[model samples]
Target chain A: MEHPGEGTRNGGSFVVSCESVSFSYPGSGRPALSDVSFELRPGEYVGVVGPNGGGKSTLVRLLNGLLKPDSGRVLVSGRDPATEPFEVRKHLGILFQDPENGLVAPFVEDDVAFGLENLGVPRKEMRDRVAGAIRAVGLEGFERREPDTLSGGEKQRVALAGLLAVEPDILVLDEPTSMLDAAGRREVLAYLETLRAEKTVLHVTHHLEELVRSDRILVLNGGELVADKTPERFLSDADLLRENRLVLPVVQRLALEIGLSPARLRTPETLAEAILAKTESGTRAG
Target chain B: MRLELRDVRYVYAPGTPFEVEALRGVSLVVEPGEVLGIVGGTGSGKSTLVQHMNLLLTPTGGEVLVDGVDATTLKKSELRRRVGLVFQFPESALFAPTVEEDVAFAPRQLGLDEEEVQERVLESLRALEAGELAARSPFALSGGEKRRAAIAGVLAMKPEVLVLDEPTAGLDPATREDLLALILGLRNAGISVVLVSHDLDEVAEVADRVCALQEGRVRAIGTPAEVFYREPAQAPATVRVASLLRESKPEIGAPVRFAETLDALRALQGA
Candidate 1:
C-alpha cells in the first residue's frame, strides 16, 4: 500500500505541503486564499470544511496544479506542482463537486480505463485495472451502461472508479456527495471508508457531520486558515464554528443545548442510547 | 391561491425509442398560505410535478387546477405570472448584465409600466435581503447572493403560488438557514409555497405538510411528524434518533426537529 513516491518528501512523511500559499481570481477585489499553509502526511484523512466562497475549491485546485498559487509555493512529493504538473497529476486523483464534469467517456468501463489508457498501460493490464476499480465501487455489472443512464450517485461512483483505476496515491474529493440523496451519500461514504487504509484522502465538504470521523480537520474562512485540529477539538468550539459561517451538526447542537456532552453523542445511535440511559436512570430514581 | 394536480401524468419523448414516464397519476394540493414540501429520491418526478404548476409543462393525461379553474384553459403568460416556478440552480439562468435588470425582466414583460416595474424590482430585492446587490452584475455575485437575486426575479412577478425546485441544493449552512427563513416569511405574507427538496431536515423544519414521491408515484403525504416518522430510512436524523429511542422507551414522541427531539427526551426523563 506504500506510495511509490513516498520517501521522496519530508523524510517520507508528508505527501503534500503548502507553504504560505495565496491566490486570487482575476478581477476579484479580494484574494480567494491568503497565506494558507498546511501539510498532509501519508495515509492521513484530512477534512477541509468552510462556507461557500471560503477558498476550499481554490485550495483543492492548487493541490493538483489545476490552478497555480499567486504567491508562495505548493509541493507534492517534494516537487513543485507549478513546475512538475505532470508528475504531481500522476500521483493525485481529484474528484470535483460535479461528477458530470469528470466523466468523459460514454460507457462506464471505458471511462474507468480512460486514465489508464492515457498512462499507456497495456491492454490486458488496463482491463484488469478497470474491472477491479469498478468492482471496488460496486459497479461491476454496469460496465457497458452509458454514463448518462446512471443516477447521480452511480455517476459519482463511476467517477471514483475512474480515479481508482489509475491507483493514485493522493485522492482529493471536493463535495463528492453533495448532490446525492441520503442513501447515495451513505453508499459513497462507505466506499471512502474502505479507501482510508491505502490512500491519503483530502475530503472537502460543507457538511460538518461528514467531518466528524476524520483524523484531522482544516477549517478555512474568508481565504484564511483559521483552525487546524483534530475533529473532536474542532467540533467542540461552537462559537468558532458559527463565526466561520458553519453550523454544528444537529445531534451535536442538541446535545450541547440539553446539557449533555456532545462528544458522547457524536452519532444518532449514541444519542439514542444516551437518551434511553437517562430515561432508565431517571425512572429508577423515581 | 390554491393549486392542485388531478391524476397528473407526464411522459417525456412520447412515442419515441427513448420515451420515459416521469410522472404517473401523481396528485397533490397546495393550500393557500401553506408550505407544502415535496420529498423524493432522484428521478422521482419532483421537478416534472412542479413544472405543471406554472403551465411550463402540459400533462399528457391529466389536469392542473388553480383555485378551481382549469390551468390549461388559462393564458400561458397569466398563469406564469400567477404561479412562479423557480428551477433548480435558478442562478445559472441569470443572463441580464445587472441584478436589477434581471429581476425587472419579468415584471416588464408582463406589461407593467416602467415606474411600476422599478418598484417591483426594488421590492423583490428588499424582500430577499439583496437590495444592496441591485446594480452588481449577476455574474459578479457569490453563489448565495446569486441565488437570492434569482429568487428576487421570481418574487418581482408577484406570484400567488411559488414553486421552488431544490432551491437550497448547493447553499452553505448559514445561507441555507437564511433561505429557509425567507421561505417562511413569504408563506406568512400569504404566498403559498411548494418546496421540492432532498434535505429532509430542511423540509421538516419549514413544511406544514410533506409528500413523499417514489418512482413517479405519491408514496406518502401527511404532517412532518406523520410522514417523516413513517419510514426510518427516509426520516431526518432527529426523527431517526427519536425512533431509535422509542424502541426502548415507548413514551418518547416522534420529534422531527432538533429542539422538539431534545424537549421530548427531557420530558421522558422528567416523568
Candidate 2:
C-alpha cells in the first residue's frame, strides 16, 4: 500500500489513487464504504475480495467515476474522476458482474462496435478495432451471432471485446466470472492471463483461487479496509480469511491442514512437488 | 416419494428456424430423503431438465413420473405444489412488500385459511432461519436474506420435493454453507432435493448421489465419490490434488473429500 505522494518506483506510475474515500447510498443507515485508501501501480494486477456488500463494487465504481465518493478524493491517472470523468474514462475500461447487463446490441459485432461509434470513430477504424477486440477475446467467428443465443462464456467474451475495443490502459472487472460455470470460468480466466503483460487489471471476485497470481489483494470487511498485502500473505492467514467470510481455495486449505505452508504451495503443481519431496525424504530416512 | 424421469426429451422452439434440442433422452430418479446433485457446464440443459421435474415444461417426449403418476397428466398447479421449483437467483422471485407476505402468497393461492397461511409463513421462515426478516421489505434485505425469504415462499407451499437451480450461485462462502445445510436439513425431514449446481465442491460435500450433464444429456450418474472421482472435468480441487498424488503412488487412492485427502496425505508422510 504505497502512499499517493510517494514517488513512482520501478518506472511504473500510479494509475489509480484513492485517499480516505467514504460513501453511503442515499437513505441508507450505514455507509457502504469508509475511509478506504489504496494505490494501483501501472501494469499491476490487483485483486479486490470481500463478502457481499463489503464495498468492493463501490470502490471500483468510485475508481470509474460512476459513483462519486461522499467524503474523499479519487484520482485516475492523476486526474480527479469526479471532476474529469471523461478524461479519466478515456484510460479505463470496466466489465461488470453480469455480462447480460453490459451487452445492448442484438448481434455480437454491433455490441462490440457500439462504444466506438459513440466516440464517433470513422467506420474503417471502428471495423478494425472491433475485429481486433473480437480476435483478442477469441471470438473472431462470433461476429454476427446473436448475443442472447451464445453460451454464458461466449457472451462474456463479447462483453470483454466491447470493452477492449475502446483500447483503455486500465481494466476493472467486478466478478466477471461469478455467473459462469467451471469451463466458462476457466475460459475467461485464461483469456485474462494473456492480458497481464499489457494491461493493468483490477479484478474483484469472491473466488480466492482467482487471486492466487495477483500481485496484491485488498480485503474489505463491513465497509472498511481490513488488510492489504500480497495474495500469498493475505490467503495464508486462515483465521483472517474466515473472519472476513472468505473461503480458502480447496487445495490451499488441504495444504494447510496437512501442516504444509500454503504460502509456498500456491498451486496444485507446487503442492504435488512438496508431497513428492516429503515422500522421497521418508524413503531415505527409512 | 420417488420422482423419476424416463428418457425425457425437450426441444426449444421445435419445428421453427430457432429450434434447438435442449434435452435428449435424459433419465434419472430422486428417491425420498436423498439429495440428488446435478452438475453440468453452461448450455447443458440442467435448467431445462429440472423444469421438467415439476411440469414447468411438459417434455416434448418421454415421461416424468411423480411417485408413479405422470406429471404431465396432473394439473400444472397440482404438480407444482407437489414439486416446488426454486429458480436461479431466487431473489428475483420476491415481489411482495414484506417477506412474510411473499412467503404466504403461495399458501394463500392454494385457498388455505388465513390462519393456516399465517402458520405456514412463520414455519417456513423458521425453517430457513429467516424469522427475523418476516416484517422487513424483501427489497431492503441483504442479498443472502432475500434469497432465504424467496426460498421460504416456496417452502411454505409444503412441497414433497424441492428443485433448486444453481442455488449457491453468486453467494458468498458463509451464505453458501448455510444454504447447503438447510438443503441437507430438508432431506433429513424426508423432503427429496434435486439440486442443480456447477460447484463440484459443494455437490461433493452435500450430495448422496450425483449426476453429470453435458450437451443436454446425462453423462454420468452415481454416488458422489463415483461421479466426481471418475469425471476429471467435474472433479473438485481436492480430488484433483489426489489425482496428482496417485500419479506418483498408485496405491494412494483418488480421494474426493477433504478428510479422505488428508488421510491419504498423512499415509504418504508416514510411508
Candidate 3:
C-alpha cells in the first residue's frame, strides 16, 4: 500500500545497506558472493532472484550477521552487524526456507513468545504480543496446537508469527514459500502482501512470479549483482530471465512463445484477450 | 513392473490420543513405464501414498500389491530394490564423502562385487548427466548438481520403478526443466515413474495420468486434462488459459500442456 520512494532513501535513511560485500566459504574454490552492493529504503519490497548456487542465501546470511563478509560491510539501520549483532538482530527478522527448522518451541503461542523472551520483554506484554502476532498471521485458533502437528501452511504462518512478535524493522525471507504447496504459498504470500506496507522486506525466491508485485528486483548470478531494475522492466526481458536461468510465469512464458510481447500480457485474462484480438485481426486481414 | 495400492490405509500414531489418519483407504495403480503424477496440497497424503509404494510406510489396513502379489509377502529389501524412492530434498541424505561412494552405497549393500558396483555407479551418474561429478565431494556441488548426484544414488540400484517426491521443489527453472525431461526419459527407457509434486504445470507436462488427493482421499484421477480442467481453479496455467479463451471463443479446445495450448491458439488465428 505504501508507494515506494515516498519517504525513505532521499531523506538519508536506509534500513539495509551493503557496501562492496564479498564472502567465500572456507576451503571453497569460488567466493560465494563477490562485491555485492545494494541498499533497501524503508518500506521497499525487494525480491532477490537467481540460480540455486548464485549466492542469494549467502547474501541473506551476511545481512543477518550469520556470516561475516570477507571484505566490505553490512549495516542494519546504519549500525554494523559484525560489531553489534544483538542490535542488528533486533532490526532484522529472518524466515528461513524451512519453517520447521526455524521453529523451536512445541506450541504455537510459546514459539511466538520465544523471540520476545530473548528480548527480555516483560511477561505481561509478551502475552499480548504473542496473541497479536498469532492473529496477524491468521493463526488465532492454532495458539495451543503443537507446531509439528499443523499443516505445512499453518506451520509456516506460525514461523512468521514468531518473527512478527519481535516487530523487526526489516524482514528477510529466504524462499519462505518454496517448500509450501499451492494453497500454502497463497496463504504466506497473502500475509506478506499486507506486511509489506509496514516492513522493509527482502524476499529471496526461485519463483519469479512471486516478484511481480515487488517494488524492485535484484538478479544475482555467478556471485555477482547482475541486474537491478523495477519488476516490470526486469521481468519483461526474456533474454535476461533466460540468461539468469530464471523462468517466466506460465502466462508470461506463453506470451513469449506465442510471438507476443512478454511485457504486454502478464496474467491469464490479459493473455487470452491478446490472443483473441490478434486472431480477430488476422481473420479480418485475411 | 506395475505397482498397485488397493484401499491402502495409513494412520500415524494409531490408537493414541495424538493419532491422526494420514491416509484413509486410498487406492491407485501405477502402470508399467508410465508417469503417474500424484498431486495435492500440503499434508494431503501424497507423501504417505508414495511411501507405501516402496514399503517405506506399511499400510495399516488393506493391501499394497506389486504385479498382483501382496507386498507384505515380498521381501522388504527386494521390494525396495524393485522400487526406489527419492524423498524431498534427497540431497540432504547424501553422506558418503565423494559423490561416487554415495551413489555406490546401495548397490554395494546389495552385495554387488566392486567391479559391478563401479559399473552401476557410472551408469547411474551417466543417466543423471552427472558422471563428471563422481570425484567431487558431495558437500561442494551446486544445488542442482547435488540433486542429480542424490538421484543417481537411487538409480544405482537399477529399480524398475522410481518415485520422486517433489523433485523440483526448490530448484531453479532450468534445473526443474531438466529434471522433468529426465523423468520422461526414464519412462522412455521402460522405467515407470511415480512423481509426487505440488507443481501442477510440470506434472501436466510429464504425467501420463494424474491422481489428485484431497484430505487423504482421491479427489480425482485421470489424464491431466480430465482431472485439471475438472478443477479449473487448480488446473495448470495452460489449461486455465485455454478455458478462459473458451469463454469468448467457444471453439478453443482445452489443452493440458504448453505446446498444445499454443497450437490451439494458432489454429484460431489460422481460422
- Chain B TM-score (model 1 vs. true structure): 0.97
Cα deviation at A199, candidate 2, in Å, is 1.9
In candidate 3 the C-alpha lDDT for residue A216 amounts to: 87
DockQ category of candidate 2: medium
At residue B255, candidate 3 shows an lDDT of 84
Q: How well does candidate 3 score on lDDT at residue A119?
A: 94
Per residue, candidate 3 scores C-alpha lDDT tens digits across A20-40 of: 899998878899999988888
Instruction: Give stretches of model 3 more than 4 Å off.
Output: A1-14, A138-140, A150-154, A280-286
Per-candidate DockQ vs. reference: 0.51, 0.55, 0.63
Given candidate 1, what's the lDDT at residue B119?
98
Each candidate structure's count of clashing pairs: 0, 0, 0
Leading candidate by DockQ:
3
TM-score of each: 0.90, 0.91, 0.94
Candidate 2 local lDDT, A190-282, one digit each (tens): 888988958889998888888889888988877898888887788778788988898887778888887888776766678878888878988
Model 1 clash pairs are: none
TM-score of 2: 0.91
- In model 1 chain A, the worst 10-residue window by lDDT is A1-10
The runs of at least 3 residues in candidate 1 whose Cα sits more than 4 Å from the true structure, single-residue gaps closed, are A1-14, A84-86, A100-117, A122-155, B13-19
